[model samples]
Target: MDEARDYIRAMGGGLLIGLPLLFTQEVWQHAVLLPAWKILLLLGLAAIVVIGYNAINGFRADATIGEVVVDSVEAMGIGTIVAFVALLALGRIDGGSSVRDIVGHVALESIPIAFGASLSRAQLSGAGDDEGREEDRRGGQTKSESEAGRLGPFQRLLVAAGGALLFALNVAPTEEPVFIGVGASPVMLLGVMALSLVVTLALVFFAEFGGRRHVSQGILDRPIPETIAAYVISLLVAWTLLWSFGRVDGASVVAITGMVVSLGLVASLGAAVGRLLVASGGEREDG
Candidate 1:
């Protein structure tokens, strides 16, 4: 059960951190333009980072050198799978694509995802509060629950907005969302909105991350409503960024809505994960 939870946390963390990059056009272009040798070198560097991270603060306590190596490989594998699926979903790579192209795309996107996976437990699983989490899993009150007051509604909204901005800031200024929006049909764009809400709910409620124990259940705090509210906040943040970046000026309503929804997918995930990390007391300032 513990191992399953760890794997889930790793995957959730990877998606939360790596999803934005999948929407990045530059990454797609790099996958196509960079040579195989360069890809291999990038993969090598990613490996080193993953291994070093696992050696210091892996999912398992007191893991040996061999265990660290195995964990690193596992992280990379998870990341590669995530990149592959996301790329396929985004229509960045299709069956007609050559094996080399697919491999290149997956490898490039997997690096940051693998980094997220490698640090998943340390960053998202409340490493500093293991005892509390264990107690939480056993249905006991958590440290955060006992010590910290639940975040109010306004605070939750603010955190969601801030997180949405952090996630969408770079993507909002780019043309990828516009390109995707213009190409997609209205139905497809609505699918994007649906997907955003689904992913956000999964990340915050169903992923079973450690911080979940601290999520408040006040007004508009139930899973479905909270998810919807966060998504709305994300869309608003997306619109603000798009407008400020001049990406939406003089655009059709359909086009603007599509862009907002495209960016909202990642923005919603950011809001959900950020609430877990920040509001639930999983995050700590580094000295």
Candidate 2:
């Protein structure tokens, strides 16, 4: 049951994630040209992506079905990884004491990998999803206060270490881009940021609609708290892979904040739309 759920979540994210680099231009175009339409459409898409992501991980918000969650909640971790990689590649990955850069980076750079991250989430989660969550439930481990009994000792240690590293990086990022071939350019930097926003909007709508419709009412007699589990698992995956691979030239907190907000609103709208569509579709069949 757990494995099935995990596979389903990752598969859904992969399918929903748009073609790599395809939406990057669109993100930039829409942000400047059609802010209103882009915002609305983006919100719808983001909502669906998040909703579908959560459902695939597990219909409940407190269970661990896979290594990653397609929802925005887990996407936070994915975004972290992508931003890390983006800045690393940009030769300017910074995690300075300011929360502003974190938000900026998320908005502009994170969009490109939003879908890819979602798609790759499954691979990252793998077996860890089951064993870690299972142990935490049985009182076999203790993580942070926020995590509670969600991860085992080793996993918790890993997350803590990863967070610590992020804190250190925020103080001062190393002068190295993870991807060797990637270059730095002021214009292209803005382009990347724009692209990230566009992609995030797309994700919002997709996540929202998919999550609500697929899960439908009365589907689960008692869905576990899949949300929490999925979120926690994704954190581990993000820390391990995305963070390691994330590379970018320049970082900005305002940008990431804008992207996250844009993504979240759209996701909610998409989810509502998905539910409405599913309900209508069922009604039509019945009639």
lDDT of each structure? 0.72, 0.35
How does candidate 1 fare on TM-score? 0.50
How many Å off is the CA of 40 in candidate 1? Answer: 42
Give a tens-digit lDDT track for model 1, residues 184-253.
Answer: 8989988988888887888877775644653446757677888899899899878866765456879999
Q: Could you say which candidate leads in lDDT?
A: 1
Candidate number with greatest TM-score: 1
